[model samples]
Target: MTDRAVAVRTAVFPRDTATVSRLAAAYHSQTESEKVERALTDGDAPLPERYAREIAEPATAFHGRRVVIASVGDDDCGMVVVAATPTGTDVSRLWTTPDARGHGVGAALVTAAIDDAAVPVRLSVWEWREPAIRLYRRLGFEPVASWDDREKMVCLERR
Candidate 1:
């Protein structure tokens, strides 16, 4: 499908559970091995349960966050979660299914998140995720800092 054919829209929590689950799984699978191992060693629940709680419980610190979903035709292809912080909006999660990688689903979701945000938006990506970094750059995000040796923070400000 063409980039123009994708539909991006705000997500409704429990109503979008299936879509969220799929995207969450995709995100989990792509996580750096070190982080995944750390989570496991810390006794965290399995990835699926952790993601479910993140989406379902306000106390999990996702209460007022904004979520966006991107779809092509009837298939949910990607999702993004933007949280309002004291400094700006932060994209906590952004994931696109493998099948949707080249169809602009990630870009569409990020655009929806930024358009709906109330402040400047920022996000962190693994330094090794070159494709995602390129996408963020294309959308006008510039590196603001290095979160660690492995992650770089990027931001997009209102013009």
Candidate 2:
């Protein structure tokens, strides 16, 4: 299919559990790299690896409790997951493969999440993730705080 014809759908279920693991692994790899960079400069270990370890084996099921995976029809274009907490909606993870960048998949997924957010929504990002930061800005999320333990930044939008 042409790029323009490609579209993203929420609630993605992969044909096999292995595919979910691979996608989750890829997601963790990218985010963990950011965490490692923060660790080197900011003096804390990346938490994702530890977090992944504690959650249990078969990480996919644990992840499903808080996040939803979206797909580009058949291709694994990207995935985003959010958790609605008492404070706000936490955009836990959002990623698009390198090949899917600039194709509106990220924005679409975020838009869907924002629409589903409960009252006020909050999301965190590494200060260095300019593309995601930019997308969040475009989607109406504004910086509200900086976190230390997470080594990332937070943004909020109240609907």
Per TM-score, the best of the predicted structures is 1
Give the alpha carbon lDDT tens digit for every residue of 1-159 in model 1: 555588988777667766776676667666734355545323344555666575455234356877788899898888888888887678867888878898888888888878757666777776566888888889878776444344333433432
Per-candidate TM-scores read: 0.75, 0.73
lDDT of 1 at 43: 32
Tens-place lDDT per residue, model 2, 51-117, is 4642334345544434444556677666676677787676756877788788787887787777767
TM-score of 1: 0.75
In terms of lDDT, which candidate is strongest?
Answer: 1
For every model shown, the clashing-pair count is: 0, 0
- Give the runs in model 2 whose Cα sits over 4 Å from its true position: 10-16, 37-66, 152-154
lDDT of 2: 0.64
lDDT of each: 0.70, 0.64
Location of the lowest summed lDDT over 10 successive residues in candidate 2: 50-59
User: In candidate 1, how many Å is residue 57 off?
Assistant: 5.9
